[model samples]
Target: MQAKAFDTHLFKRILKYTKPYKKRYYGVVMFAILLSVFAALRPYLLKQTVDDYIAPKDEHGLLLYISMMGIVLLLETLSQFYFVYWANWLGQDIIKDIRTKLFQHILSFRMKYFDHAPVGQLVTRSVSDIEQIARIFSQGLFMIISDILKMLVVLIFMFYMNWRLTWIVILAMPVLVYITRIFQRKMQVAFEEVRNQVANMNTFVQERVTGMKIVQLFNREAIEYEKFKDINQKHNKAWIKTILYNSIFFPIADIISSLTLGAVILYGGFHILDGDKFTTFGDLFSYTMFIGMLFNPLRQIADKFNEMQMGMIAANRVFDILDSDKDVQKDGTVIASHLKGNIRFENVVFSYNDKENVLKGINLKVNEGETIAIVGATGAGKSTIINLLNRFYEINSGAIYIDEQNINEFQMESLRQQIAIVLQDVFLFADTIHNNITLNNPNISREAVIEAAKKIGVHKFIKTLPGGYDYDVKERGVMLSSGQRQLIAFLRAYVNNPSILILDEATSSIDSYSEELIQKATEKITKNRTSIIIAHRLATIVNANKIIVMDKGQIVEEGTHQELLKREQGYYKNLYDSQFALES
Candidate 1:
């Protein structure tokens, strides 16, 4: 659906967030009513004081009336403070809830969604776009409603005191409203472009910053900066359109307001008679004040409408993410229990996108507690096998089962809890080594982590570090060596005690010393558990119980390491020769 600046459906949806804070929301509306009442009463009170007391030169209880006006001012001031405070207070909370929901929803999305999604765009939606929505509350919706109410009350008073001047003032209003309608249409389209540009800039900046090491290493800093400059230029250009609209509209609005005030003053000056109640000097003074109240808000409507438009545009983007139910992985009713290590892929076929098949029809099986090492070249569907086993992506055609039960029959969380995957590039949070291992799971204690580390033979090495497990790894475990980080990952896997373990080229890119530690850790973790190891390096899988050789997404051969090497021209034979030949 196309986005609109003032869509009632969309506006109502945004308002529903206030349901949890209905009391505060009602408080805002009540304060708005009080402000309008206070504002309208001001001119009426002044008119009475001028006509009855000041004009007639009466001194009785003049101080009391003055004090009453002062009290009204104080009450209005107090109401104003709460109005501003609660409105902003409410906005902060709404964003907090929205940000939490957005992040949580993003977390549950399948790996396929992340494969095509830009991290920066998601960040912008959660951060920048949501920030704009807050203005819808703090500066746009309630404030606009308050202004409209004040204008309505002022108009009622204007017609009551003098209908002639009231009629004259409203004559110019239709033109103002017409012009505002045009501005709204123009600004809505412009604000949408501005938001688009913002997302583009965010995506570009995020990618560049995250890959800054590559940028600097390749000496492409100047090139990247130029590209970013181009993006920023487009962003500035989009904003300039909105700025141009405001620059033209506000002045025209002001001119119309000035003309309305002028008309009221010219007519009121001619009819100011001392004794006539409607045409009295006091009535004339009240009419001028009434015009300011009425026209001032009318003047501000365009600007506030811009804020609402920006907010609605932002809401459209945010809701787009929240509404993408298609990307969320399907949930299952059954919880996995006492999972056995038996795994099978029956004629499984898969693809990231629909057109090209990444995994053609294939069948494979592994017995309970057996370790199967898959050896394949790049793009041979090595990692895809691991991904499908974990249900990261659903197979195009065929079923995967564990212990004779379909894997999809189990809840996603339950299924994953039984599996542990250690990737080639280990990712550790900017937290302590202990926190990264247990992932703050609460159930897994420090002693369990230590036991796991000791089982993996890294406990002594960890103790050598300044704070042992307490040492902050910083972002991505940059403070630790590749081998140390790998050891931490092995410790994590050991602690999980998963029914199935998959190591996807885990030691391929690491230092030899780290590779040695990982090999030892692998031996400890794989015992008495099903393990699937995907490796490019042939020497690492020589001792596997069985070996599966893949070529072009199809399994070509399956046997023990020595049996595969015995074939005259087998895919595994060639791969093993080339890999070990280089090592020799």
Candidate 2:
């Protein structure tokens, strides 16, 4: 991709976040003005002390000048403190607001977006990139403004003191400005490289760490380490390139600043020795200080300009996500309450990617409070049916209805709230078991969670743990066994009292004893409720009210266990017999 230019439109959008804190922003600007005023007064007072008081041998006048100079310095120091404090405070508040907004936007995106986007890249944007934006407010824009004001005030005094010496000093400025412009362009490119490399490194590390198990299991530690080293080297080189640019540019600026000071002294010294009444030793002294002051802000402006460039680049990345239109379909206005659980899929066709259909023209129906079990091979589109019913992805064509009303007509949140799912890979947050089960929902009280856990038959297993329901699961439930995590998922779904429940390969990867317990729990939970079970093991769904056998995105058989078994050469019979023969 071509590098994004610094976008004024995006900058204006970022500035809107600071609107609520306009008073604080104004406070920073006011303090910056006061700081500049005080800074200018210091050298002017120093000149008066030397020329008017010390040269005249007036002790009282000298003392007054010294004291006033001290007072100006003190006020300058105070203004500096407030300027820094308030500017940083404003930056932090703006970034906090942006981070919250970015996160909320991310949450609204469809699963399809996440399927292709890297988790670490998103994390880096929300955390590190947002921080760069904060620096624009705190260390970049406001500070640059303060520096410019100070330089302008100093220049005014320089011209007033001795316009001839001021002209000599100003002659060297164009060279420095030319050099700074070139440096700014190069630094902008360097900073962009650094940010890109950082994102790449973050993505690699996050994926490897999350999949560390596979790395060690396959004994690929050395190979992975080498890959990480390569990424790290690229990151290091990108940073060094930035450092190299800074190292060359700042010294050139310093050299130009010194040359300007030299020119001021050369001209002022000639006029002083010529016994010109217009030029005095104090004028030369004040002019020297003012020359340094003029060039100092210019140098800082170059540095702060690079910082602003970085912030703009970061803002471009953040805005890309914010502006994305690939969010979940959430346009339905109907609020579905107490759905009777009647479901019908009519001529449904779907595809995760647009290239090929996963479920091709499927049609099925289940009455209220019936348990329907789906059995199919690995890629037979069994789970895709459940994904469609939950509206995780939009169907390419056809319609899904609940209670004789099209599912699309129901509001997304209301429809999802009425359905609960227990997936084969159970995920638990790093929190107490109780919080994990209730998911921090205040309405699901502790007593209700405990009662639900008991109904699902996972209550005794939870109580045996040291903290019972309060036990922390840690990370992705690493503290618990696979079966325990499954049980927790069951309790979580059970407490919601969903009108429709889905158990997708819920008993596939567990010990036989846990399987028996889960089966019993399943019997209780599936009773008098609409349930769909996706199972690979044919025996698990033998008692299902109606069994639907799928093959390659098409339903091949539909019947009870006995009815399907009686069919000669049927897909369900063949699948059941193969497993049964293996056991025999």
Q: Report how far residue 236 has shifted in candidate 1, in Å.
A: 1.0
Candidate 2 ranges beyond 4 A from true positions: 1-5
What lDDT tens digits, residue by residue, belong to model 1 across residues 53-139? 888788875666677788888888888898888998998899888888999899889899999889999999999999999999998
* Highest lDDT scorer: 2
Using all chains and alpha carbons, the TM-scores for the candidates as numbered come to: 0.96, 0.97
Instruction: For candidate 2, report its TM-score.
Output: 0.97
Model 1: how large is the Cα RMSD against the reference?
1.7
lDDT of candidate 2 over 1-584, digit per residue (tens): 32354567777888899899999999999999999999988888888888999899999999999999999999999999999999999999999999999998887776778888999999999999999999999888899999999988988888888788778777888888999888888888889989999999999999999899899999999999999999999999999998998899889999998887887777778888998888888887787678778888898798898888898888889988888876646658889888889999999998889788899899999989999999989999999999889888888899999999898889888999999999999999999999998899898999999888777677899999989989999998999999999989988998998999999999999888788888998898889999999998777888888999998898989989899999999998999999899978
* Worst-scoring 10-residue span by lDDT in model 1: 270-279
- With a 3 Å backbone cut-off (N, CA, C), the pairs that clash in candidate 2 are none
Native-vs-model 2 lDDT?
A: 0.89
N/CA/C clash count, model 2: 0
Model 2, 54: alpha-carbon shift in Å?
1.5
